[model samples]
Target: MTTAYWCVLIAIFLPYLATGAAKFFGAGYGPQANSDPRAFLAGLQGWRRRANNAQQNAFEVTPAFAAAVLIAHQVGVAEQLLLDQLAVAFVVSRLLYFVCYLADWGPLRSLVWAFGMAMIVALFVVSA
Candidate 1:
């Protein structure tokens, strides 16, 4: 498979990784863990809350990214190298976004999020 295809695979699971990290960081495991997962998440603070927010953000961006990839492929975009590079940029930006969110780097996280969105937009633009 192409690197772009592999990027799509990684994108598919990225949100789950964030969600798992949120749960782990929020202390949602072990014998004393709360039975209500929703309550557990709702009570999170600081970095844990940021992790959950990142998880939600990941979910929010995923469909757009996936659609861009699929549409770009179907429309036969001639710039394979550009498509691959943008795909990689999107994935890397997302990973950095997650880190920035968890680390509470508000401005940097916003910049990373914008970068990821830009990558997706570039995919569609290049394909068109």
Candidate 2:
């Protein structure tokens, strides 16, 4: 598989990373949490709450990224390396975004979010 394809796979699971952090750091996951995970996560505050937000954002953004990569591949962009690089950058930006969210670095998080979206746009442009 191409590097970009691998990145799509990584993006698929990235939200779980943020959620895992929230669960591990905020409080231990228990039966109640397992029963109603959203309710349990909703009760979180501070960094944990931010982590949940990040996870939700990750879920929101991942679909576009995955679609961009797939569409790029289907359309068969000439710059395969460029597509891979952008995919990697998107993943890196997402990691940084998660850190910013957890650390409450609002401005930087927003910038990283923008960067990730730019990468997605670039992917589509390359496909075009």
Candidate 3:
């Protein structure tokens, strides 16, 4: 598989990783844990809340990213290197986005998100 294909795989699971972190940090393990998962998520504060938000954002971006990858492959884009570069940019920006969220870097996080979105857009543009 190509590097872009591998990036798609990572993007697929990234949200779950963020969600797991939220669950761990917000509710934790053991008998004392909240029985209601929704309640547990609702009660998240500070970094945990940010983590959950990041998880949601991860999910939100995934469909577009996946579709772009599929479309690019189906269309047989001439620039394989460009496609791979955009894929890497998307993954890296997303990772930084998650970290920025956890760190509460509001403006910087938004920029990172825009950068990731731009990467997705570039994928489609290149495919066209």
Candidate 4:
């Protein structure tokens, strides 16, 4: 498996880890809930929604990376160093993107998301 593939896996795993961290820490709580765990549960639930979205995006990239690999092979654009950098950049950008999303940094998160997508696009384009 390529480094990019590993990065993709990490991207998918991060959301779950974040949610788990939220559970371990604490999120939502109210006097009416009659329980402190309720807030934590609510936090987990909210994290689930965000994690699901992240998962969807992560899965979308699998095929995109695979296609890039195939195109690279077919076109003989085997620039291994560039491919490695793109893969690493995609992975790191995705991690940062999710962090920003969870942090609720308006606009900044979207920009990171776009940057990550751009890396994927660059892979396909440069390979061709």
Best candidate according to lDDT: 2
Lowest lDDT 10-mer window, candidate 2? Answer: 24-33
**What CA RMSD would candidate 3 show?**
1.6
Assess the local accuracy of residue 66 in candidate 1 as a C-alpha lDDT between 0 and 100.
Answer: 89
How much does candidate 1 score in TM-score? 0.91
Model 3 / residue 105 / CA error / Å: 0.3
How much lDDT does each candidate structure score? 0.87, 0.94, 0.88, 0.64
Encode model 3's per-residue lDDT on 12-63: one tens digit a residue.
9998877778887544644555467666766778888888899889999999
What lDDT tens digits, residue by residue, belong to model 1 across residues 43-78? 788888788788888888988998999889999889
Model 4 Cα lDDT, one tens digit per residue, 23-119: 4445443454335643544445555445545545556665665566556546755676777688788778877866776666748978988887788
Clashing pairs in 1: none
User: For model 2, how many clashes?
Assistant: 0
Best by TM-score: 2
Q: Model 1: residues >4 Å from true position, as ranges? A: 26-28, 31-35
lDDT of candidate 1 at residue 96, scale 0 to 100: 98
Q: Residue 112, candidate 2: how far off, in angstroms?
A: 0.4
Pairs that clash in candidate 2 = none
